[model samples]
Target chain A: MAGPSTYVPKSGFERWLDARLPVVRMMHGQFIEFPIPRNLNYMYTFGGILMIMLVSQIITGIVLVMHYTPHADMAFSSVEHIMRDVNYGWLLRYMHAVGASMFFIAVYLHIFRGLYYGSYKEPREVLWILGVVIFLLMMATAFMGYVLVWGQMSFWGATVITNFFSVFPIVGDTLVQWLWGGFAVDNPTLNRFFSLHYLLPFMIFGVVILHVWALHVTGQTNPTGVEVKQKSDTVPFTPYATVKDLFAMVLFLLLFSYFLFFLPNYLGHADNYIEADPLVTPTHIVPEWYFLPFYAILRAVPSALGGVLLMFGSIAVLFFLPWLDTSKVRSGAFRSIWFKAAFWLFAINAVWLGWLGSKPAEGWYVPAMQIGTIYYFAYFLIILPVLGLFETPKPLPNSITESVLKKNGGQIASGAGQPAGATSAPETKG
Target chain B: MAFFSSRSLKSLVIAAAVALVPAGSAFAAGDSKPPRMQDWSFAGVFGTYDRAQLQRGYQVFAENCSACHALSRIAFRNLMEPGGPEFSEAEVRAIAANYFVMDGPDSFGDMFEREARLSDRFPPPFPNQEAAVAAMGAYPPDFSLLAKARAPTRGFPGFVIDIFTQYQENGPDYIYSLLTGYDEEHVNPEGELGHYNPYFMAGEYIAMAPPLFDGMHVYQDGSPETIDQYARDVSAFMMWAAEPHLEQRKEMGFRVMAFLLIFGGLVYMTKRRVWSAVDH
Candidate 1:
C-alpha cells in the first residue's frame, strides 16, 4: 500500500474516469490493496465496527426524524405513536437507541485497544487526537438525542447537566440561560436539542471520514505493535481483514439484536416513558450508562467547580496521552510486568468508577468515587510518565515477520532479514 | 489484575458486560429496594404475552381502574389487534360505542357528544390534571404508559443477572407490588386518606390510594378474581397498553437472531477459509 500504485484501469471509460478523478484509485489503494499486519486480532476489527455503527445510527436517526415531533408538547406522544401506530417504527426506534449503546461499546473497545497497543504513539498522535474529538462529539450527540425523547429523565437530565454550567463565575447563570434559552429546561431547550441531535451526527460522520483518512496515513497497529517492515509480514486489507471484520460484525449484530428486540427498554430508564413535566422531578437523575464514569468523577470532589473540572479533565487528559506516557515501548505485551499491572488495574478501576457512579453519591460510595477519581488521574499523570522512566520493556523482535514466525514456534521466516535482539534500543526517553 | 486470566476471552467479555450493566437509573427514582422479581408469562427471550390473560387483564382495567385512570394512548381498534386482547371487530365497535366521546361541530359551530368511533382514543375521566388533582387531592397518573413509567431498583449483582435472565419486567413488577402492597402491615397512610406505599418512587406518599381488592372483578373466564389476581391482571393489562407490540417484537427478535447466528457461522467459516493461507 505504501509503495507506488499498481492499479491499472481496465477499460476505456475506466481509464477516462481514472484520468479525470482518481476516486477508484484511492479506494483501491486504501481498501483493496491496503496492507495490515497479519497478526491483527479481534480488537483491530472495532474500527470497522465503529464505522458501521455510525452509518446505522445516521440511517435510523433520519427515519426517526420523519415521524418524531421535535416540539416538547408532542415529543413524548410522538414516540409512543411510533411504537404503537407506525409500522415497524418500534423496530427502528429500538435499533437507533440500542445502536447508540452498541456504538459506544465498539468505541470503548477501539479506544482501549489503542491504549493497549500504543496506537497513540508517534506518527499516530493526530489520528488519536481526532478520535478524542469524535468521542467528544459522540457524547454531545448522545446527550442531545436522549433529551429529544422528552421523558421525565429527558427533562431532568437536561436540567441537571445544563445546570453544571452554572458553577462557573459571574457569567455562569447567563451561560446556563443561554444554554437553556430560558430560565429552565423547557420547549426552547428541547427544540435546540432536537435540532443539534440531528445535526451533530452528520458532523460526527464528517470527522469519521477524517478519522479513517488519518488512520490510513499512519496505518493500523496490531497486537504485536511492531510497525510493518515488509509486505510479507502483512496481508491485503480485502479477503483477510474484510472477512474478519465481516465475521465480527455479524456477531456484534447478534448481540445488538438481542438488546434491540428482546430488551429494547433495558438500556433506557423507565421514567423516560412518562412525559416530561417541569413540575415533577424523578428522585434520581442519572445520565445514560456511558456517562456514569464521568459522572462519578464529577461528584468525587466536594467543590462543584472542582468536580466539573475533574470530570472534564478525565477526558481532556486523554488528549495528552501520547506525550504523557514516556515509555518508548509499544504494546503492554512487551512492557514490564509493573506496567501491565498498572494498565489492567487502571482499566478495572475505570469499571469500578462506572459502578460507583451509578450508585447514589452517599455513604461509602462517595469516598470510593474520590479514591477511584484519584487513581483515574494518577494512572495517566503519574504512573504512565514515571513508570516509563524506570521500567524495562521486554526485548522486541527484529521485525513484524520475525514476531509472527516466533509465535508459530521457531519457523524460519525468510522475510525477516535482520536477526532478533541484534538491534537494541533504550526504553527510556533519556 | 490477571493479565491473561484462565479462559481470558470469555472472562474479558463478562468483565466488559459487567462494567456496562445498566448503570445509574433504576426503573424510576432512587427507591431503596428493588421490586420483587416476578415470573411473568412474557418475561424471557421467547416469552409472549398470553392472549387470554391479556383479555382478562383488560377486563380488570375496564371494571375497576377506568373510573380514574385513562388509557388515552389506546384506541378501541387496538383491542382487536392480533397480539393484544384480540377482540372481534363487532365487539370492539360495541365497546367503542359504549363510551360517549366528544364529537365535532356539524353544520353549526358547536360541539356535541356521540358514540366513540374505533379510531377514537379512550377519554379521560377528568377534564384535566388540575381538575383531577382538585377532585382527588392528587392527580391520577395516566395509565397509558404507567406500566413503562414505573420501575423499582434491582440492586448490584442481581441487576447484572437481569440482563441475561431477560428480566425487563420492572415496571409490571413494581406496579403489582404497589397494588398488592396495600396490606396494612406494609402500608403507611398519612392523615385521613393520604396513601403511602413503600413501593412508591416519589417517597412522600403514593398519591393514588389502593385501587385493587379481593374479587375486584368477577372473572368470567374462571380465572381467580382475588386481590393478587386483580393486581397481576391490571398490571399485565397496563404492560400491554404500554407496549402493544411485545409479542410481535419478541417473535421478530427470534427470527432476526436466528438468521444472524446462522449467517455468522457461515461468515466465520468463510473467514477461516480466507485466512487459511495467512499466518496471523
Candidate 2:
C-alpha cells in the first residue's frame, strides 16, 4: 500500500528487532521514501502545521484537566486559582484556549485549499470524508471545552445551542434533557461536558491516524492539480517536503505565539470572563468566531426547526462536496472565468454571513443575511454543478515537469528536464 | 454574446456593492459612540504594565471602589507575584491580616469568621445581592473579571487597523473612560441618583457614581493624585488583575519567536542542500 521499505539494519540487535516488529521499516517506507509532487506550494504545509497544533493542544489540555474542577460551583473559581497559584499554569491555559482558535484557522485554510485545487475529487473521497469527520469531532470537543469554563457565555451558550435539538419534534425535549443530564444546563451538564471534552480529543487523535493513513494511500494532491507521471515528477518526502514543512511550522508558531502572549483575548468574548448566571442572561450571546458562519445560517431562517435544519445542513453539504461540483478539471487555475467568479462570490458570501452573525438580528442585517445564505447554498447546489457542464477548462500540461518547466520560461534542458531552480546551482556540472 | 462576455464584470460590480452595504450602515446615526482610546502602558505586542502604576491603581481600588465592588478572584499574595504590583511579602501578609474571612467549625462544630489568610480570596463587602442592592440601591459588579468583561466594540476601519497594530487595550480603555466621563450639567434618570456616566455601555447612566476626585487619594510616593491620574492607575491595576502574567507572557513570546526564525532559516538551508540533486 506504501512504497517499498529500503531500511537496512546495521547492528545485530537492530536486525533482530527488525525481524520481529518491522515498525522501523514501516516508518521508513511511509515517511522517508514516500513520493510527493515536486510542484506542491506553501499551502501544502498546513497539514504538518495542523499536526503540531493538535499535539500542542493535547499536551497543554492534559495539564489543564489536572487543575480544572468540573463542578459548577467550583469550576470558575478553580480556573482562577490556576491562573493565580499554579506554577506556569497560566501559560498552559492560554495555549489551550488560543490553540483551539488557531486550529480552526488552519483547518479553514486547509479546507479552502482543498476546494481550490479539487483535492476531494476521485480516489481521494475517503481521505476528504475523514477530514470532515475530524472537523466535526473538533467542533464537538471545542464546544464542550468552552462549557467547562463555567462562565456566563459557557453556561448560556451550551443552553442555547443544545436547545436546538428541541426542534426535532417528538424526541427533541427528551434528547436535550438526556444530553444535559437534567432539565437545564446545570451541574450535571458541566460534569458531562468536562468528561466529553477530555474524551473527544483522544477520539480525534485516533481519527487523525486514519486520516493520515488515507492520505498516504492516495498520495498528496499538488497545486498544479497534475498527477506525477514518473520519477522526475516527484521528490522523496524527507529532505524536500520535510524541510519545507519544518519552515512553515516555524512560521505558524510565530503567529500562534503572537496571539498566546500579546493579544490572547482578542478572539474571546468579554462576557465569558463573568461567572455563569442562569437568572441574569448576558445582553449579547455569541459563540466563538469559528462558529459564526454556522450561527449566521441558523439565524437566517425565521422558523425554529428550519433554522436548526439549515445550520446542520450547511456542514452536511461539505460531506457531499466531492460529488457536488461535477467539473473534471482539478484546479481552479484552469476553470472558466465564470466558474472562478462564482467561486470567489461563494467565498465572499460566507465571510459576509460570518459578519452578519455577530450583528444583532434586526435592522438591515436580517435581509442581508438571508441573501447571503441564499448565495451560499446556490453556489454549491446550482452554480458549481451547472458551470462544470458548460465551462471550458484550459488545456492541461502533459505532465507536472512540463508545467514546472513552462512556468520557469522553459529555461531547463527539455529532454532530461532538469529543474531550473534546483538547489546549489553552482554545484551543477557544466 | 454581450450577456456572456460581461458576466464576470457584472458579478464583480455586485460583489463590490454588497461589500459596501456594511460600511455604509456603520456610519449611520443613532449608533452608540465608540469609546475613546487611551495611551495604556500595556497596549502593544511588547508593552508591559508599569508596576508602580499598578500599585497606585490598587491603592485607589482598595480605598474607594473596593467598598462596593468585590475583587473575589484576587488573593493578597497575587500583589507580590511577577508581572503585578510586586508588593513585599511582608506587605502582602499585612494586607491579608486586615480582612476577616469566614472559616469554620472547631470542636463545637460551628462556622466562625477568622482573619484572612494569604490564600483566601478577597472578601465581598456584602453577603448577597439583596443586601447589596438595599444598601446602595443597585448591584455593584465584581471587579475580579470586570476589566476583561467590559470593552467597546471597535467598528469598521478602526477594527481593521487594530489587527496590524496589535491594539488590545479595549477593556482598560473602556474602564478609564467610564471613570472620567461623568457630566454634571447633564443627568440621565435611568441610573441611580448621583450616578451619571455617558461612557457606560448600557445607557447614558450607570449605578455606580463617579468614585474618584482630584487629589482624593493621597500618593505618598510623590505621584500626582488627579482624577485622570487615578483613573489611569486604576485601569492599569485592573488590567494586571485580569492578566497577571502579562510581562512573562510577552517576554517568553519574544524568545520563542526569535528561536523559530533562526531554526526556520537553518531548515530552509538544509532543504536547499538536500534538494541540490533533484531534476524536475
Candidate 3:
C-alpha cells in the first residue's frame, strides 16, 4: 500500500534528524499523512479509545501498585488504606478497576466490528491474528490484576480458575500446583500474580505496536469492503480520523466517568470488599463479566476435560477465521442474507452464552449453555465454511469512492475547496 | 443513505428482535426473597448523605453495636472531615478520648495503653479472631467494610438494570433487611446460640442475637427513635464507612460528565469541519 512520502521537513533540524534516524519521517508516513478509508463508521474509533484506555490504565495501575501491598494477609487492608488514607486514592483505584471493564468493552466492540465487516479476511489475516494475541494477553493481565485485590472473590476466583488446569491428564495436578506457588492460593500466588500482572500489559503494548504496524501495511477495509483504488477514495488520518476518534473517545469517557464517580463499585463484586478467607467460599464463584462467555463454554459439557477443550477451542477457532469463511467478499455489506442472519445470530448467541455463564451450572442453564456452546462452534466450524461457497453476494461497487458516490444520490457532495496541506495526492499504490 | 441500506434494515430488524428477547432464564436461587429496594437519600447521581442522619447513626453505633462490632477503619478525626458527619474538632477530640488504644513502646520499653488520639483507629473488642470467636462463639465482623462486604447477589435483569439505575445500596439494603428481619416468627432458630434469618447471605441462620429493639436509643435531634430508624441510620453510617468519599466522588463525577459533554460538542463541530473538504 505504500506509495510516496507526503511529509517534508520545513526545518533544518528535522532534516538532520530524519537523515540520522528517520523516526519522524517514519511516523509522518505511517500516521500523520497516512490515508484511511473515508467511510469508516464510529466502530473504528474503538482502536483509538483502546489506546487511550491502555495509557490511562498503565498510569493508574502504576499509581495503585505504589500504595498496594502484595502480601495476602495485608492486601485487603492495604487497599482500604489506599481508599481512605492516600490522596485521591479512590479516584486512582476506580479508574484502574473501571478502566479494565472499559478496555474490555472497547475490545469487544472492536472485535465485533471486525466480525461484522469481514475485516479479518484475506491480507488482513495477520492483523486479525495479532488482535487475537492481544486479546489473550489482555485476559491473562486482567485475571492476574483481579487476583491482586486479595478478597473473597479474588481468592476464590483464583482458586476456581487455576483449578481449571487440574483437568489435564497426567500433568494436571502438577500444573495447577506450579501455577500456585504453594499448595493453595496464598502469599506466593499473590506475589507472583502481581509481578506478572505488571509485566503483561507492557507485553500487550509491545504486541499492539506490531498490530498497528500490520494494520498500516494492509491498509483499512471500509464498510463496503472495497479496497482503496485512488487518493479520492480515502482521506488523511490527521484531522479527519483524529477529530472523529477524539469525539468518540470523549463520549466513551462520559460512560467511563459515570461508573468512575457514581457507580464505581458496580462492575466490581461485593465479595471483593471482604478480605480473603481460604476456610470458607462464597456460595457463588463467578468471574468478571468479560470472562463470562468463556466461563459458560468451560461449563457447558458434563465432563471436565470436555469443557476445558471446548473453552480453548473457542479461542483457537478465531485464529483460523481468515481461512474458515472461504468467502472472497470482505464485507458483510455485500454478503447475502445467510451471512447476515448467521452473523447476528452468532453475536446474540455469544451474549446469551455470557448470561448463561453467570448462572450456576445446574438445571435448565446447563442445557441452555450446551445449546449456546454448540451454536458457537457451529458458526465457525460449519456455517462459515459452507455458506461462504454457497451464498451469493450483492454486486460490489467498482471502488470505495464509487460506493460513496452511489450512496449520496450518485453525486459527490458540495465543497471543492483547496486541499489541506499535505493531505492531497496520497497516491495509494492499490 | 449507506447505513440505512438493505443490509442495515436487515440488521435493525435482527437487532430489535435480539433486544426484545430477554437475557436467558433468570437465576433466582432457592426460595430466598429479594430485599425491598430502599429509596436511600444517597441512591442516585445527585444523592448526598444526610448530615443529621449520619450523626444519629454514629450515636446508634456507639450506644449499642460498638460492644461487639468494631469500626476499625474510621478515626475520630474522620468524623470532623467535610462530606461526613462534620462534627466539631472539640466533639471529635472528646470522642477520641473516649477509647483507649494500644500505643507504641515507650521509653521504658513497654507497650502502654492510653486515650486514643484523633489519628488512632477505634479499638476492637477482641484482640484477635480466635479470642473473638471464643468469646462470642462466632466471629464478630469488623464494621470497616461490612456494608460493602455484605452486598447480596442481584441475579440477571435486575443486575443488568442496576447499572442504569445506579442501584449500589444492596449492602445497606441487606443490612437493614437483616436487622428488621428478626421481627417475624420464622426468623428465630430452634436453639439458643443461633437465630434464623432468611436474609443472611451465607446461611439461613445467624450467630448474633437480636441487637436492635423498638426504642434502641433516643436521638438528640428528635428523629424517629424506632428500630427501623436505627437500622436505617446505622446502615447509612456503615455505607459511609465502606465508602467515605461517595459525596466527593459523585460531585466530581458530575463535573467530569459535564466537561466531557461540552468537549464532545466542540470536537464534533471540528470533525464536521475537517470532513467537509473531502467529498465522496
Candidate 4:
C-alpha cells in the first residue's frame, strides 16, 4: 500500500481545491485503479442508467415545484396552467410526466437484470436489497405525486387505494380513517400526500447512495460466469464502463424524448382534465401504466383482503430471493436447463398478469389471473429450489480471461501453467 | 486479510447505522400526520368555483386535466351547442383529429376532428365498462352529475361545517379568498384549525393550487397581464363549465312536472271510454 506523501502545489487554486475535495485523486484511485471484468454486457449498464434517471427526476421535480399548486381544487387547473400558460410549460410538463414513466421503465429493467445475472448473490445481496428498497420508495412517491394533481383520477385513485385498508380484519376502518385524516379522501389527504411526495425523493436519493456503495463493495458481476483473477483479466472502470454507460443512457434518452415530444399524452387518461367530483364518480379509473402488473395481482384474488395481501406479497417476496434460489451456481449462463426454462416461463407469466390487469374482470379473466398469480409465486418458491437440486449445469471456464479467449477462438497463452479446470474449485469453496 | 475484514466490518456498521436512523425516526413519528396544505392561495386553486365558466373553462380544463381526471357525464355532442363555450365545430374537429375512435365489426377505428356526429361521444379509454372498473378498482364518476350532487350549500350547516373544516370562504367569496389568501403565518393561534394554506379560500388547507398564469389566454384582441385577473377569469369559466345547462335544466324540470300532472288527468278521462262497453 502506498503511504500519503507531502505535496507541493504550484498554484493557490490547486492547493485550495486539494484542501476542499481531493476529488481527482479519489476518482483516479477508485475508478481508474479498480479492476473489473472485461466481458460485461449491456445489462451491467442499468445501474448507471438508473442513476441518470434519478437525477433527471430530481431536477425535473424541482422545476415543476416552481409552478405547481399543491391544493386539491387548484391542482388540476394549475397543471392546466402549466400546460397552456407557462412559457414552454407544455414541454416541461410533458417531459416531467413522461420522464416518470421512463424512470419506471429503467428500474424494471434494472431489477430484472439483477434477477437474470444473479447479481443479488452472496456479497451483492445488500446491493440488491437496497435496490428493492429504492423500488418501494419509488412506488410510494409516484402514487402520492399522482394525488397532488387533484384531478378526477387523482381523487378516485386516492380514495380507492386508501380504502384498500378497509380489507384488514379488525382495525381496517380505523386504519383507513388514519390514512385519510378524515371520513373521506378529501383535503387533508391531498395535503399530506403533497408533503410526503416532496420528501420521499430525498429518501430515495439516500437509498440510491447505499445501493451504489453496496455495488462498489461486491463489484460488478459479468456474463461469462467466471470471476476476476489476475489484473490482466480486468480493465479500469473509468473510460471503459463510463463510456458504455453513457452510450446506453444517451440511447435511452432518445427513446424518452420521442415520447415527450411526439405523443406527450399518449400514455395518459383523458378524463383527468375534468376537476375532481367526490359525488359523481367517473365510469372508469385506471392506475398509471407502470403499476398494471401489481394491480392485476390485487384483482386476482376474490376477497379484498386476500387481494391486498397477494399484491403486497408479490413485491415482498423479492427480499427472500437470495435465500430461496438455493442454486450453487450464481450466473444464469451456468444454470441448468430446467432453471433457464423456468425463468422464461416466469417472465411470460408476469407479462400475462399485466395484460390481465388492464382488462375487465369477467368470464375467463379471473381464472387467468389466478393462474398467472400462482405461477408468479411458484417461480420463486418451487421452481428455483427444485431446479437447483436436480438439474446438471454446463461446464464453466477457469477465469474471465479464459472465457473471453474461448469466445474469440484463441487458445490460452503458452506457459501460463494455471490449470483451465481450476474455475469450479473457488466456486465450490464459496 | 485484516484489512479486508476490518473494511467489511466498517461497511456493515455504516449500513446498519444508515438503516437504523430512518427506521427510528419513522417509528418515532408514528404515522406522522399526513402533510396538510399550508398556504391559503393553494387551497383556493383547488376549491370548486362558480357555474358560468363551464364552456371556455372546459377547454382549458380539457387541455390540462383530462390526462389525470375523468368527467364521464359530458358528451361530444354537448360541445356543439351555442351555449357551449370552449370549442367551435372546426376547433372540436381539430382537437378530435388527434385521437382514433374505434367503430364497427372490423375493429377498425378512425380519427375524429370537426363536428362530432351522433355516434361521437367521448370515446371510452378502455374496451368496456367491466375493463375500466377492473383496472381502476372503481368506476370514475361522470362530470354531468358532479355539480348537482356536490354543489355547496349556503345555510347554517354549511357555515358551521365550513368554519370547523377550516373552510374560510364559500362560493365566489370562497374562490376569491382561496386565490388571494396565501399566508404562512395565518395559522389559528389556538391550534383549532390546522396549517394555513395560502391557496385555500376559507383559510383552510387545500390540495389544489391557484392555476392561473400571468397571461394564459389572450382574448381575441389584447388582455391585461395579471395572475389574479386570470385566476378570476378561469374561476368564472370553471363555474359555467361545470354546469353548462343549469338554468335550462331547472326550467325544463318545472315544465315537465306540470305537463305530467295535466297528462295524468287526461289519461283518467280516456279510461272511461274504454270501459263503457264492459260497464254492463
Candidate 5:
C-alpha cells in the first residue's frame, strides 16, 4: 500500500502500524507527494467544489431521512412537520435541495474545462467515463429524491419520465409497470423511489473513489494541455493545489449559501409545493433545470421511440467522445480558430437547448429544438472528426516554463533564491 | 486542396443529413403574460418579513379564505413560530380551540371529534374534494402551500436574468395580481359560470369570486384596511406561510457569507504565501 514511500516510522506504535497497515504512508504518498501539473487553473478547482457539494448533499440528506416519512399519505405532511417542528430541519432540507443544483453547476464547469483542454484525450478516457457514470447516478438520485417530496411536479415528472421506457414495443408497458412496482405510480412507487434515492449516493461515492484512482494514475491535465515533461513542470499536491482548491471551495460555497438562504425557492417550480394530485395535472410539466437539455432533445423528435432514442443517444455519444474527437493538439488555445468557434457554438447550443426545453414543445420551439438537436449530434459525430483532420493549429510552446518566462520577459528568476511563503508568485503555476 | 479532395464529399454528406431533416411548425398556444413584479418585504439578500403585516394578513385569511380553502399543512404551533407572524402561544392556543378536529377512535372503536390542539393542522373546510366540488361547483384548493404553488412562467431571458437579479417574488406577485385583477368593466366573452379575473391563469374566468374587498378586515395595528392593502399584506403573509424559516434563513446566510468571505481571504493569502516559493 505504501508503494515504496520514503516515510519512516518515528515511534514504536507508528512502526508497528506502518508494517501492518501502511495506510498513513499511502495517504502521505497519494495526497501529499503526488505530482500535479502546475499549470492547472481555477477550473480545476471545480473537482474539489463538486466533492464538497456531494458530501454536503449526503450529510444533509441523511439528516432529512431521519425526520422524513416514506409513505405517500404521510410524506408531504411529514416534510411540513420537519420544516415546522424539527430543529434546523429547514436548513438541512434547503442545503440538500440546493446542493443538488450546485453539484450539477460545478460538474458542468468541470466537464466544459475537460472538453476545452482535451482532458479526456489519451490515458484519461477511463477517468472521464467514470465521471459520466457518476453524473448519470447523480441524475437518478436527484430524480428519485424529487419524487420523495410527493409534490404535484414530483408525481407528474415521475410519471412523464417513467413513461419514456414504455416507448419499447413489447417490454415497454411491462417495464414501466415493473419500474413503478404497480399498475400506476402510487405508494409502492414512492416507497421504492425513496429507497433508491437513499442508495444511489453511496454508489456515486464508490465510483468517485475509482474516478480519483484513475485521475491519480493519469496525473492532472493542465490548461496548457502539454504533458508534464520534467519535475519543474509539476508541483506537489499539498500546499499548492490544496490551497488553491480551498480558496475556490470557499468562493463556491458562498454562492451556494446565497441560493440556500436568500432565494431558496428561486430555482424551484411553484407547483412542487402542492401535494401530488393525480387527477389534477398542472398545465405545464417541467423537469428540474439541470435535466432541461436532454429533456429538450427528448421532445425534438416527432415519434416517441425516436425521441427516446435520441435522448439516450445524446449521452451515449459522450461515451464515444474520446474516439470522436481525434485532434493531435490537446488545448483549444492551440486549436484552429474554426475549432474553437465550433466548440463555443456547441456549448451555446447546449444552453439554448436547455432554455427551449423549458418552453412548451410547440410552435417555433419545435423547429428550434430540432435544429439544436441536429447540431448537438453533428458536433460530436461530424465536426470533431473532420475538424481534427483539416484544421491547422498554432505553434506549440517549448515548455510550460518557457511559456511563462516568455510572458514575463525572462528577467525574473524562477524561484532561484526566494524563500517560500513571502508573497504571491504571479503565474507560478503556468 | 488535398484536405478538400479527401473530406469534401464526407462533409457534404454530413451537411445534407443535417439539413434534410424535416422541420415542424407548431407554436405554443398561450397568451399568459409574465406576472408583474412587485416590491416585497422579503425581496433581497437582506430582506426580512414584516411581522405586523403578516399578523394582519393572517387575520384576513382566517376571517375570509379559511371558509373555503384549507391550510392543512400548517400546524397551529407554526403560527407562533419565529420568522412568521409570531403569534403568542396563548393566542395560537385560543385560535386552535376555536376549530374542531377529528380524533382517533376510542377504546370502543368509535371515531370522535374534539377541539383542535396546538399541534393540529388547520382543518379543511370540506371533508373531501368531492364535497368541496359539490359545494362550490369546483374543488377549492388548499391554502397550505398555495403561495408557493402558483407563479407565472418567466420564459427564457427573464429566467436567466432572474438568477443575477434575485427575482423570486413571482409567487407573491401573482397572488396580489389575482386578488386585485378582477375586471368589472369587461364581461367574460364566453359567459362562463366563474367570474372574470385577467390575472387568473385559466383565461379570464376564475372559479373563486373576488375574495378581497375594500375595508375587508380592520387591522388593529392602524394599517390601512383597503382592498389593495389587504391584497399585498396577505400575499406577504402567504409568502411567510410558504417559507416560515425565511427570516432565519437570511440571517444565517449573512453570517455564513461573512465567515466564508473572511475565510476566503485567508485561503487566498495562504495560497499566495505558499506559491511564493515558485517564480514565473
Candidate 6:
C-alpha cells in the first residue's frame, strides 16, 4: 500500500484536480502520516465498536419502522403483527430490541475507558466531553423509543416519567401539559415521541462523527504510560488496530446472538403482553433494566426535586471528570492503594443502587437506596478528588519507549534515536 | 513541578464547581397529587371472543349463525386450527371440495384444504376484500385488529369507576358481564335495542348472531365438550395468536437484562484492566 518515491504522479483526473485544490495533499499528509501510540490495548477498540453499533441500530430501526404503525389504535397490534405474521419478523424484532441494549453496553465501555486512562485530560478533553454529550442524547433517544410500543409498560412508563415534570413547582403543570400535548399521555404524545425518536438517532450520528474527529486529532493513549515520540513508538491505525477491533466486534456478536435466539423475551416485561389499559393498572410498574440505576437514584431522595437533581447529578458528574481528578499522574496503575480500593467500592455501590431501583419502594428499600445513592455521589465528589491529591504514584518511566523496553527486558534499536542500552542518554523529549 | 501542581489545582476547582452546583438544590420535589392508579381495559382479555374462540365460536357460528349470518373474513385455514372457524385439512377438503376457487388460466380452481403452511397468506372467504366489505357493510372488521379495536368499546363506565375504588380482580369485569349477560326477560325494547344476546357488548342485541355452539369440535384432548370451555380455549388461543411474541417478549426482557448484567460486569472488568496502570 506504500507508494514509492518522495513524489508520485497523479492519475489523469487527479492531475487536473491537483491544480485546483492544493490543500488536498496537506489534508492527506496530516492524516496519512499521523502518529498513534503503539501500546494501545483492546480498550481503545470501543469507540470503533460504538460506531458499528450506531449503524446497526439505525439499519434495524428503519426496517422495524417499515412494519410499525405509529397510530395509537394500530401501534400495539402492528407490533404484534410483525412478531407473528411477518417473515423473519421474529429475528428482526429481536435484533432491534437487543441491539438497543448492546448499544448502551458499548457506549458505557467507551466512556469508562476514557475515565480509566484519563483520555479526557488536556487537549483531549473536548473529545471526552463530546462523548458525554452523545451519551446523554443516547439516553434520551432510548427513553422515547421505549414508549413507542404502547404496551402496558410503555404506556405506564411514559406516564410515570412524563409525570416527573409535574414536580417542577409552579410551571410544572404547564410543562406536563406541553409534554403530553393534552391533559394525559395519549395519541399525540405517542406521535410526537415517534417523530422525535426517528429524528434523534441521526443527530447522535452527527455528534459521533465529531467525537471521532476530536479523538483522531488527539490520537490515542497507550498502556505504556508514555506519549508517542519517534516513528518507532507508533504504528498505522489500519491493518493492526482495525483487525483487532474487528475480532472484538465478532466476539461481541457471538454473545449478542446467544440472547437473540435462545432467550428473546428475557429482557421484556410480562404486563406488556396484556394490552395497555388506562383504566386498569398493573400491580407493579418499573422501567426496563438499563434505566434502573438512575431510577433508583430518582427514588432515593425524599423530595421530588431532590430525587430529580440527584438522578441528573449522577450523570452530570461524569462530564466534570476531566477536571475532578487532582493527581498529576494519568493512569490508575500508578495510583495509591486507597484510590484503587475506593474505585472498586464505588462500582459496587452503583450496582447496589441499580438493584435498589428495581425493587418496589418500601420500608427498607428507601433507606437502602438512600445509602447507595450517597455512595454513588461520593465516588465522584469525595473519593475521586481526595484520592487524586493524596495518592502517591509509582515512579513513571522517562518515556513510552523506556517503559516498554524495561518491561520487555530488551532494547531494540529505535530509529532517529540512540542505540539500545544507551540508558544514560537523556530521555527523548516531546 | 509548579506548573503541574497549578494544573492539578485547576482541575480540582473545576470538578468541585460542577459537583456542587446541584447539591444546594437537592430537595426532591414532592408529588402534590396522590399516586393515581391508571385504569386499563380488561375487556380484551376477559369478555371478547378471540378469532380462535370465534373460530370455535365460528363452528358455533357456522352450525348456529352460518344459516343466517356469515363471517366472510374467516378462511379454511382458520377452521383447521383451534383459533378460527374453518375445519381441519381433511374436514376443509371434505367440506369445501363442493365449492370452487378461481384457478389459473383455466378459471376453475380446486377447493381449499384444512392445513396451513408458513408460505400461505390467510385465504379470504370472499373473492376480494371489496366484495367482503360490500357483503358485511363494515366487513366484520378483520379479526386481526378486532381484539384491540373492540376491547375499548366493551369497557363500560361502571368498570372504570369501580377499578380504583375497589381494586378487586385484575382482568376486565365488564367482559365477564358481557360474556354471560344474556337474559330474555331484561330485553325491553328501549333497554335492549337488538337481538339481546346479552353476550353482545351493547346489552344483548347485536347485528351478528350468537356464534357459539355448546359442543362444536370434539376435544382432541378428550376434555369436556362444553360451549363455555370452547369459548375459554378459543379466547386463550386467539390471545396467543394475536401476541405470539408476548411470552418471547417478556422472556427476552429478562434475558436482555441478564445480558446487561453480564455486559455490565465485562465493562467493569474491562475498566479495571484499562485503568489498572493509571494513578488517580
Model 6 scores a TM of 0.64
Shift of residue B279 alpha carbon in model 6, Å: 24
- Residue-level lDDT tens digits of model 2 in A4-110: 46688889988999999988877877777787887888888999989999999999999998998899889998888787678888888889999999999999989
Instruction: Go through the candidates in order and give each one's C-alpha lDDT.
Output: 0.82, 0.81, 0.84, 0.61, 0.81, 0.60
Error of 2 at B77 (Å): 1.6
lDDT of 5 by residue, B1-280 (tens): 1233212322332221222232221212144444667888888888889989889889989999889988877889889988889899999999998999998789999999999998888999999989999999997787766777887777667877888888888889988988888888766666567787767775667789889888778789898879889989889988888888878888889999999999999989999887766643
**Is candidate 5 or 6 superior in TM-score?**
5
The better-scoring model by TM-score among 4 and 5 is 5
DockQ, computed on Cα atoms, for candidate 1:
0.29
Expressed as tens digits, the lDDT of each residue in A382-411 for candidate 3 is: 998998898889999877777776676545
DockQ of each: 0.29, 0.27, 0.27, 0.01, 0.27, 0.04
List the candidates' TM-scores in order: 0.92, 0.92, 0.93, 0.60, 0.92, 0.64
> Per-residue CA lDDT of candidate 1, range B61-113, in tens?
88878888888999999999988889899988988888988877877988999
Residues B1-280 of candidate 2: C-alpha lDDT, one tens digit per residue: 1232222432332222222223333322224456678898777767888888988999999999989988888888888877889999998888898899887787799889999887788999999878899999888988877888887777666766876888888888888888888887874546356556657776655677778899899997889879999999998999888888888888888888888889888987887776555643
Candidate 3 vs candidate 6: which has greater TM-score? 3
TM-score of chain A of each: 0.95, 0.96, 0.95, 0.91, 0.95, 0.90
Model 2 scores what on Cα lDDT?
0.81
lDDT of 1 at A30: 85
Clashes of each: 0, 0, 0, 74, 2, 55
* Poorest stretch of ten by lDDT in candidate 3 chain A: A413-422
TM-score of 2: 0.92
| C-alpha RMSD by candidate, in order | 8.9, 8.2, 8.8, 26.5, 8.0, 15.1
Model 2 iRMS (Å) reads 12.2
Structural RMSD, model 2: 8.2
Q: Which candidate would rank higher by DockQ, 2 or 4?
A: 2
Write candidate 6's Cα lDDT for B1-280 as tens digits. 1233422432332222212222222221121111122232212112222443434433433343333333322345544643233345777655454444443443365543444442243444555546865775534433333332223211234334533343321222223333334454654576534445533432224444445555666755455677556545544433433433443443454565566667656755564543233211
